[model samples]
Target chain A: MNRRQFLSWLRRLAKTAAAGVVGLAGSRWLRAGFLGAEAAPPAQRPIRPPGALPEARFRAACTRCLLCGEVCSAMCIAFPSRIEGSQPPLRRAPGAMERQELAPPVWRGDDTPYILPWKRACNLCMRCGEVCPTGALRPIAVDRQTIAREVRMGVALIDRKVCLPWTRTSWCGACLTACPYRQRAITVDHQGRPTVHPEHCVGCGLCVEVCPLRYKAIAVDPPFAPDRGAVRAE
Target chain B: MILRGWLSRRRRRWPGGARKVQVLRRTLQLLVLALLFAIPTLSLYDNLRNQRDEVGIQSRWDTRLVHRLVADLEEPKALTQAVRGSVWTFKAGELVISDPLAVVDFVAASRVPWDRFLITALLPVLLSLLLGRVFCGWLCPADLLFELAGKARNWAGIKTDVTFSRGTKTAVLAAGVVAAVILGNQVFAEIYPPRIVGAELYLWITFGTFGAGAWFFLALIAFEIFVSRRFWCRYVCPGGALYALLGRYRLLRLEVDPVACTECRLCNVSCELGLDPMGGRFGQDCNNCGLCVRACGHDALNWRLGLPPSGGVDRLGHPESGVAAATPGEPAP
Candidate 1:
């Protein structure tokens, strides 16, 4: 109503405008932390299995309760979006990585290394687990994201050309039975040795778990040093 | 007319001395009832009206039982004004008898403003400690509901299924505390046991689907209608349990006048909390509804405010007789 009050109002308006700009800019910038481009390439991030909690329990169990997000020692547990009908599709099971991009085929890949980068890993302090009342992640559970498991022992390769099922007319469905993602994710090839489905296979080495062969035909290639060859091309 | 005539005839049948006593007791009963029922509403109404006018406001009354705990948590700076907001915000030497968090959160958030925390949490506990669950029997809304429930039970021919156990309430209290600690300060306000189920419903309906503020309010009425009796207060309320423990050693308590009672079973029938007010452990979970007093066929039972005996109930008067036999003096509880 008065001149001084008007000036004070103007000051408030200016401060609010500045805050708005900063807020927008901050959101845009933080995308680097969240998005697939800067954080992990879209394919590398892992998948969260379906039907974790119904949409209601997700929100009912929380009041924006504590600053679980802010207090998190490891940034693995962040508040899910408060958007309209955007709660779930959260992870039902505990895996190494979470999918950043929610496009086709759900999440990226487990143990892809970038999904949970070696440095930015969950410390298993149970801060996130303890805080969640709905038991999304139990405080004490065997199915947890452990840093030790993801270290690459070697690369695994299949003899796609000569595997009995893929090459010939025999019904040798050995590999399909052994695959871990189970329920026949690995298809029977022409001879029926089993051809790998890239979508289903997460390179967990479970198919290689049971290969009944003399020299262990389906095996991991041990990681090697380039200097072991001792050759100088230059 | 017929009922009034019947009651009048019943009175006439009694002795002249007892009839004279009945008239006096009835008048006293009416006044006490008005204080118990009417004044709380008036206090609320006047408190609101005075707030709008700001000139002829009632002098500030403090009931700071829990407010002191909340003082250190939320606003340590504006303690005075914050304390001034609730009637329970009385100052004391390094201690306040108020649920400060409730008052602080209510006044501060302005999101979910309620007076129940101070009234239910602070006032009842202090009164219970001083006068032993006076509010439970006298003033609280939940206790009021429980009285209605007792009548409803009789009408429906239903009986309580569970025997008394403090386990459920103790667990609820621990859970509320742990949740508050894990969640946030006063985060337990969701299940505050009187807000009580309304806020939880509000959270469920509002957050789970297409929710709005109004829908949350709708959740409130729906919950109040469906929730059976004082289930929350009796079994699950942390605040009620706290008051129960605090009032354990209270100086003044519900005393039986042995000289007065006619064994009419009116005291047991009148009690909303199902306490045999004439029997031992009369104060346990007694909401002090005074229905027992009103129900007395004769002016037998009165909540005589006196210091509890040295051996507690041993020195107190009983109802089965008609003369005061003890020393004409109050003994310490």
Candidate 2:
């Protein structure tokens, strides 16, 4: 090879080496971002699908393939859209476009599926977990007992002020009847007032869906919420 | 008889079987797109029966013909599940296959089992090593869209030749992987067009509603049509960049025989990625689409197995010329 040929070869080599170094540096930076320090956790805990791992681990493991959402029979599982003032915990590097959105938006809990009970309630079909390619949502049996034990979607909170039976406006046993756990999780006393046993309640939200009152008498709160004395015995 | 004679003469015009290969490629692309759309539709119909049975709803209309046809064509649940992902499948207690770029992100962000990595990332990596980014040419739905855009641009006489450094895609891929790790999610998977197409179609058939991601997909198509020609695949797509890197020194490469040189620049025009087959300067950017090879009327350009010299020898087999020949790394000007 002559002088000019050697220089051209060296230029190509240098370019390739530079790319390799950039790739390595970027990867190292990312690794540091992931393992070195943790970002502040989101303030509000969204209700995750059944069998979901803890928040941090769930985020790490999920590939965001949307298989869980696709397999849901109840169509209860929904991804969060862009919500103002809520940013995803993962921070993009400087120069990355903020408003120029891609697949999952920048909202906290955007890619992960959550059940909104008012729209539709999880019937404990267990199909989401079953179809999850990544084990982010651990696959559990579709049996009622299994779901009641393994799935703690949320806790039921009943407002006595709004409840028809509790307010003495009407006798309503709808919540008690709709509870998948029936006598164990929910029960109606002689006065026809339905009481929720938080310890047994899986918070599948069937009661919320089936409530006949104009305003929902019972609402499902996120699983981690502290129990308040909402349900009263006759 | 005159029409038949004219047709035969037209067929005889292009020699070296170029038209035949072009037809084959076009057919394959269309068939793949059709299959992508069909799988979800059939799966929806098959599951609809079970749904109706559970609800105890009976239809008086005898739709046996449509039902039977769909049922016959319906893919197994496991197979349908596999198709849910663009590059990975976890099925029957095994990680079936995965794209290497996804695997890189998965490994970086999460603690996946070693066996899972071996099962999923190994085959695609191996195939890419041998073939060199053939999937971008043969499988990617974006390629079809970009080709149509290119055709439209040509028809409309829009001569927009925007070029970025070939390294831009590699940089983008690296940045994307880093972002995925930081985000603790495969964000690239969400924006990837082919996967989005499949996911959108699946959602539409299953629930009659699709997500906001569908709008993102439409925006990308529109950008391809109006803003840049093949920009996403050429400069922005992380998956394509990863494949190109993996298959840089691919086994099956375009070889131009020096002796059979009738220096026609048709091959140059035929390359959608702007590679120069006549000059024998194809880099990782060449998707091995065979369009340039098909365009070469001189039977000079063909896919051959063997490593060509990095940069040496002129068209007449003479060594050490005045100006150095263009290396694969150097993009065509």
Best-performing candidate as measured by TM-score: 2
Tens-digit lDDT string for candidate 2 (A150-229): 77776676767777998899988888887889998988888988888877888788887788765566766553312221
The TM-score of candidate 1's chain A against the true chain A comes to 0.27
Question: Evaluated with DockQ, which candidate comes out highest?
Answer: 2
- Poorly placed runs, candidate 1 (over 4 Å): A1-83, A86-234, B1-125, B149-151, B182-187, B197-229, B312-333
In the range B105-212, model 1's lDDT, one tens digit per residue, is: 333332334433345345545566776545444434334444455554554445544434544765666666555444333443444433332222222221122112
lDDT of each: 0.38, 0.64
TM-score of 2: 0.74
- Provide the TM-score of the second chain in candidate 1: 0.49
Worst 10 residues of 1 chain A by lDDT: A106-115
